[model samples]
Target: MVRLMPRKGERGNALLVLYSALIYLFLYLPIAVIILFAFDAKPIPGLPLNGLTTSWFAEALRDEKLVGSLLTSLRLAVISAALSTALALPAAMVLAWLPIRFKSLVMSMVLGPVVLPQLVLGLGLVILLRAAPDMVGEPAIILAHTTITSSYATLILYSRFLGFRRSYIEAAMNLGASEFTVFREIVLPLIRPALISVFMLAFTDAFGEFVVAWFVAGFTETLPITIWTSLRQVISPKVYALSSVIIIVTLLLSLVSQLWVIRQTRLTSKAPSA
Candidate 1:
């Protein structure tokens, strides 16, 4: 019996698929390992698979310090993400559409936090906060996270606005719509998906940030700080359990944000009927 040989194009496609699969596996295998160990009955995480158990998750939830820190992180991340998005919106609009001198300098300044080392940024913020001791706890952490996350928010919105149709705004103006009305009715609706995506990304970044938060945290504890403290002593399986929860939540948020963007793109791509 004669066997059919695959064409060169088929071999190339197969290789490309295999290459992509390997890359994804490399990136995600460590995360999978952590999730697996979180459910493993083995007290110390390692090879030789132990029976699966959910006790670690319960223990993590029951730990007052861990739970409290998780809540604090949630609160901080929400406030920071909101504040960052709020600040970034106007800045991105200006950068994307407005004609201003020294625009490059302004952009660089806005993005400084993202490029600067977190340790140095933390130190700088610590020094700045010295005068105001009252803001050394949650307030300080929120401010620091906002400063860092705003840069990313700005970048995302700026890119979105760069491709935005200015004709919409001009048409609104011709129809006697005020700038505020135009923004609220026109720009806001178009960019809502981008805004939501930026907020989700900022929230995830702030939630996981530890270095700057550690510097300005003072007596305040976040989940990352708590995990770091736990790591100093004997590591607990509960830490892994908590981490798995965070990873799962982050993945969900990311997936939702991506889907939102994709859906919006599809909806926008269809031309309006005559």
Candidate 2:
């Protein structure tokens, strides 16, 4: 019995390690290939990864369509993030402090997109907006992005607001501070990081979102949609270059969020109690 128990324990540990490695490999193996192929000198993906080349990266940068697509994507992201933040701030503030009984219901409505499939949402929007052709441009893109990102913005900012010290406002009021003054001096600074985080999220998602933007802006192609077009019928190594750029930028953003920007959101060392 003792010998059997020892053998079982050893097998369990071995299985655990093997499973862990397999999971990681499954997750990263494709990404590793993408990175590897991005640098390959060959025009084709699989053949002769002999030497690395800077030419692909240069072509990616210089491609007029790619450049235009990048600019359009940036514009879409900026507009989306800005609109989302603008709409979410007041909504979140009310949600945090208002004495509404159906708070859960309201929250579900706000956070609906988190569960909803992006494709379904996109297709639905397309059907609904099919009657209105005039709304396809920056305005349509902005509205779609706002709808998609507002919930995220609200949730993030509201979570921060939950831990906020209301007494600071009370104390200021007791000392005859104006409502406007208290909000400006206290509330805004405290929620700044939350706003920034939401903005970043909104922009990132908007820039990469293929389906919704494609549907919402029928004639107007944001960068992702354009990139898809470039990829499909007219595939090229330039796509690899663009993919490489996207991967690098995304990785950098993730690093910044994890290491610098989010860490700057110091919750523990908050303002002193009232």
Best by lDDT: 1
lDDT of 2 by residue, 1-274 (tens): 2554557778999999999999999998887777777777887766568888768888888888877878888988998899899999988888998888999999999988767998988888777777876887667787788899988898988887787778878888999989899889877876777777788889898888887787777677677887788667745667777777888888888787766555655653554666
Worst 10 residues of 1 by lDDT: 265-274
Candidate 1 wrong stretches, greater than 4 Å: 1-15, 271-274
lDDT of each: 0.92, 0.81
**Residue 191 in model 1: lDDT:** 89
- Predicted candidate 1 versus true structure: per-residue lDDT over 1-274, tens digit per residue: 6759988999999999999999999999999988998988988877777689999999999999999999999999999999999999999999999998998898889889999999999999999998998999999999999999999899999999998888888988999999899999988988888999999889989999999999999999999999899889977999999999989988987897799888987786563522
Best by TM-score: 1
Candidate 1 Cα RMSD (Å): 2.2
Candidate 2 regions with alpha-carbon error over 4 angstroms = 1-24, 267-270
Q: For each candidate, what TM-score against the reference? A: 0.92, 0.86
